[model samples]
Target: MIKRLSLISASVALGCIVTVAPVLTSIYIADEDAERREQEDLQQFAAKAVMRTELVTYQAFAAISDMEAPPGGLCSATQIAQFARVVFNYRYVRDAGAYGGGQYLCSPLSGDVRAQHLTMPPPDWRSKDGYLLWYRQKNPLSNERQDIQIGRNGNYVSIDPQSYVDLIDPARRPIAAINVETNTILALSPGADADDMLNAWKLAGQVNNEQWHYAVARSASRPLGVVVKSPRSSLVGHWPGLLVMWLSIGVVVGGVLGWIAFRRISRQLSFPATLEWAIARKKLDVVFQPIVRLTSGECVGVEALVRWNLNGRNISPEIFVAVAEQNGLIQQLTDLVLDKTLDELSKLLRSRPSFYVSINVSSEDLRTRRFLDVITARLQGTGIRPAQVRIEATERSFMDADATRQTIAAFRNAGHPVYIDDFGTGYSSLSYLQTFTIDVLKIDKSFIDTIAQDAASSVVAPHIIEMAHELGVEIVAEGVERDVQVEYLVQRDVQYGQGWLFAKPMGVNELVVWLSESSSTLQPIHQ
Candidate 1:
């Protein structure tokens, strides 16, 4: 009993150590949560500030646009100049000017000063002593002609004004001008501090570094972004408390359980689980899912998903793949999956030359020269065109954005299509969509699950479809279950659909029959 207790203690300690590494790596020393919360609060504040300021600026510009030439109403050149000056002098406004009939109607109000127009009186003002000379000279060396030099025949260029106004009919009213300025409406928003808000904006902007900022830029009217300027030290400041909480939990429950587990397992029992041993032991298997075309009922592809047979039980790929990855056996495991998947695919390949098979490519495969040569050889041996073979990748593989880009280019150069699996769920989703020459974006099942229920997803589903359409990237919705989900995706014009809605993953013969039946129902009628 005493020996068992000691063994238990050691096993618990080992478990604690193993679990702590990943969890602690996830943890930070400072109060990032608090800082993030603070940042979010500041962003809200900033957004509110922007909206308030923007509305005020918009109103100001609209009012200025409403003003006509002054006799009975707010028209005189002096009045226009003063109004421009006053609007420009407003806290957010940077500069203001007015133009009429190809001449400066009034001096510009830039900074704190206002300069009157040299030719507001027109013909009389144009012919005066310095005026005639001003008209005669190629370019006058005076402040009065600065406007004349810069202004086109009948256009006004207002600098850094509060808001923008453009006259609808410039041909009819030569004096009419359009006013546009930075507006800086977002600066007035309320919420988190500017730094935190900015950080959140930056994080959100970094959405896989795919250049999704253009979306925000296109939707610039929504001031939901922030530029975090806080120091890294500030970000980590609040993490200590959470770390302590976690560590305390670790020391008590985690440590005790780990020590027990380590003690129970004997060294003699921990032999290498060889591939041959696994296969002989019935520890290898494959799950096949059908990929169909969006517009028709054509079964264009089948993705071979590999699963590990563990001690007579089917273990999830998630568990063993991680184990293989952690133990430096990922390459070996990947080879096993690929070989098994391709061998299985070969049975279906002959009848389905048009049928494509997609296998996942790991970072390990991309990094190794041998892996690339092997994949190439396999493709040639199978008589599969480079385009027929698709290599699926996760965001992390692509997050080493530079390497991923080069790898993708190489794959494309070889004629195979590369797809981002679980797309739109990664850090650089937008960036990858924009930067990498990806052929297909397999939308994550998470988004699909919510599509039928979430309003946000309803808008987002169509938006993603439209954006992908713009980029010429095909959108494939995965993990679809219901008829509603399929119908929704079809309506949104998703390019491909895969999930239980069609059929669950099956074996070779079963899949062949399922494919034949599915084809009958989903066949395309070509004209």
Candidate 2:
């Protein structure tokens, strides 16, 4: 009885720690959370600031770059209509005109410049590029607002000042600006204190003694920066609530675990039991991410992904799948997924006979004829063809050559094309390519991401492509998010593509709606 009591105490404590670790760690790092939140906020502000300021600068510079001295100079409307038309297309410019002698410039605003002239105050600052700029110059058309008027030599453009800081939260009073050539910090928003802004910029990612948070963010392309400061108390408002919530969770978890440990210690109430229970109760969910043909952009098929929830919280398939593999529960798990998959996709695959669904199986599943038998049994009544189901085994599955090769042959003989998933990431062998008769190779996302990059693996993709071409197997690029990657794959005449660029993983209902809604965009392709 004493030994049982000790076991209960240890088990409950272990369970409690495992569950409450993240929450407790969160409490410890809540201070850092304020810094992170502020950094993200300032980053957004900085990006907007730089984008707006650069766009306005671009408009002004573009007009300046394209502008030449009018044959009639400042008093005449020499192609003033052309200049006005260009400015109309862009939302930033308040005015455009020629500048000379610090006075009376012909502009879109100056209808008859020979008779009426808009005088200029001396510029607030001069840029290194021989351009003159005014800060918050009062609008002659409306005293209620101001604009930034900048010009050089024969032309100038005035930008609406409000557009620069429009996205900023007015309540936060954050300051944003662009650093132009010659290290000039051009302010975008009003009420900027140069010293305070600079101090916050240097003291980024730090909490002050008074519990105030200060942060600064800079753009990668330019010297544009945003500086913001907030009271730590504002962001940490839910601290007490979260503290109480986690504490209550700990108490409840510990009590439940104590009860479980006391009564269930003699039985198999561990992870395997929980998994077995979940399988029996049908607690696993399968989501499908579409795989499309590269050239035609047709939704050719989908890959089945398994998801599990334990005690109302999601457990990553990476962790739990490994658990299943280690505990020899993978076959049962695969069976459950296979049964669910055919039931869900039977209608879709049957309607689109050309389309196929790929299912990932473990190294263990590929060792013998049992897996093929299970699959054959599952597809018996679903109206789904064996050809409509593809088998995916990672490179690790091919390590056990005799059994895996036999299984792959059985699957292929049964009309299921075998694919080597995440091909380059596993197993140090070119032997698998010579040995396993895989119909397709799904290049891992890691290699796909390296396309056109300066990384060392950038060269590896071309070699992999060349090797695949030599072997006569089709290619499927995974995790393709960028147009550049699609272009790269398309240029190589790769067969298929999959990732967020096409579609995200979704449920059966969503997939049906998606396929129906997006059919117009997809072109029919033959396998």
Candidate 3:
């Protein structure tokens, strides 16, 4: 009994360790990720602020550049005042004037201050040629400190620092702008302080501070730099909630491990179980590939393809569909594909009554009544005619020959067309054409792809088309991506074609735009 008690204690301890280690590790990683994202966001914000400031500065400079210098080499009082008024109309320009001969010549606010012998202060920030300068000085009218810029030809434009500062989003974080040459604070948001602002400037491009994080980006067009600062707490505001979730997960995992130590339980679940979860959450989506008429190059129909977005990754349809079919989940997947296709294409179908959308179905889907019921229910009041919906099944999907034939006949009786998809790649049995009521034969991409490579080896596609034509079935050549391929299909009298050359698979909104843009040039198939 003592030995058994010791073993139980050891197992419980090991389980707790196993459970706690990962939760703690995940929390640490989460904190690090949050910090990294915060730094990146701050850098982006600073870059944008600097860019906006530079644009305003450049606009003012451009306006000044357009003004011709007075003929007498000194701007008259009237001309200076008028130029200043034009500059002041811009949002960022606070005042404007002309300065020459170490004297203030004229200004819109204080015209002709020539007697003052005004001295132009050495610029806190200046261009290489001393053409553009930004400095701080007292406003002659308001008698308050102001930031100003001087152009090359004695034209001066004062800047409203408040306008530049207000461009930074105050609700995001504490931000400030400073001159790189003079180390002067050009502007600062309400919550920011001089001490923190200076610290942030020093800590630019670094995130090692324990109390505060800093990001800075200098404008390429000017000498100004923008700094974004945030307290460590704000950077990791979600840490507490993450900690609670991790703790709860740890408790549950530890209990499960401990239970497994005593009771032998199978931990492996089937693929269908996971797939069922995905289906329940509606993680399926549909994309449409246009089918064009070769002669007129007009889109006549679209093929609906289902996509699986699982865990932020896209899983290929071939792998998932095969697994689903083996595990008896194909019916559910097919039903979902049908519902999503009809719902998405309903608008296009209603607007263009002649347009058709094809949906792929598996052998299992054809064998069951549930598939037909799903299609019927989804199209009841959706403004989609029964004929507008086409069913496409592969040659192998006809393995249950009787059931597939019955389904196809029933579908045809209800005004829906059934097409044989991926022909010449699958079962490729001639009996499929003779036995089932196939309306369209879509030659697989494998055959169409070989048409350009080996003329002799690619003879199968033409023969297939001839045979399909003899049986009164329309031909659709898939993967027609080249001009040569289009010419070949049109020459062979192929009715419908689809490939990336025309358009790749697109979402509903993109299809609507494409249709609107191409409608004028598109013509219906001859027959």
For model 1, the local distance difference test gives: 0.53
Off by over 4 Å in 3: 1-270, 521-527
Local accuracy of candidate 1 as per-residue lDDT tens digits, 1-527:
99999999887667666866545443442345555554443333232222232333333343344333333322345555655655455433332344555345443443212243344333212211121101111211244322211122222232222121111211211110111122122331123243433343435423332111101111233222223222222433445774566556766676665455445433312423554367445467877888877567577887888876655777677766766676676777667767777777776776667778787888766654555667788767566666666788876577576766777888878877888787654434353466779888887786688776733233335545666788898888899788777777777678688888766888878988888787677654221
Task: Estimate, for each residue in 1-527, the C-alpha lDDT of model 2 and write its tens digit.
Answer: 99999998787667666655544554456657666665555444443344444445656776766666455544455667756764786556778766566564566776545344566789877766687777767655677777777778757778876555554355555564545333344564566666666656666535364555555545443334555555454434566775556556665665665465556544433777788788888899999999988877778899999999777899999877877897888998898889889889998999999989899999998988998999898888778889899999887678789988898999999999999998665533234687678899998897799898865345446657876898999999999999888888888888899999889999999999999877866664322
Best by TM-score: 1
> What residue pairs clash in candidate 2, if any at all?
none
* Per-residue lDDT over 1-527 for candidate 3, one digit per residue giving the tens place of the 0 to 100 score: 99999998787666666765554565576678787766666665665556555556665676676454543445566577567656666656777777776456677778778887767665556667566565556666665676656566777777766555564244557777777766667777777786767666766646466877787777644677777777664424566675555455654566675466435323224456777778767787889999987878788889999888777988898878877887878888887888788778877799889999998888877876667777787788787888899989887788788887888888888778999898865422343576677789999897798785643225457657776887999999998888888778777888888999889998999999998887776764333
Ranking by TM-score: 1, 2, 3
Q: Residue-pair clashes per candidate, as listed?
A: 63, 0, 0
**Cα shift from native, residue 391, model 1 (Å):** 0.8
Error of model 1, residue 83, in angstroms: 28
Candidates' C-alpha lDDT: 0.53, 0.72, 0.72
RMSD of candidate 1 to the true fold?
14.8
| Model 3 clash tally, residue pairs | 0
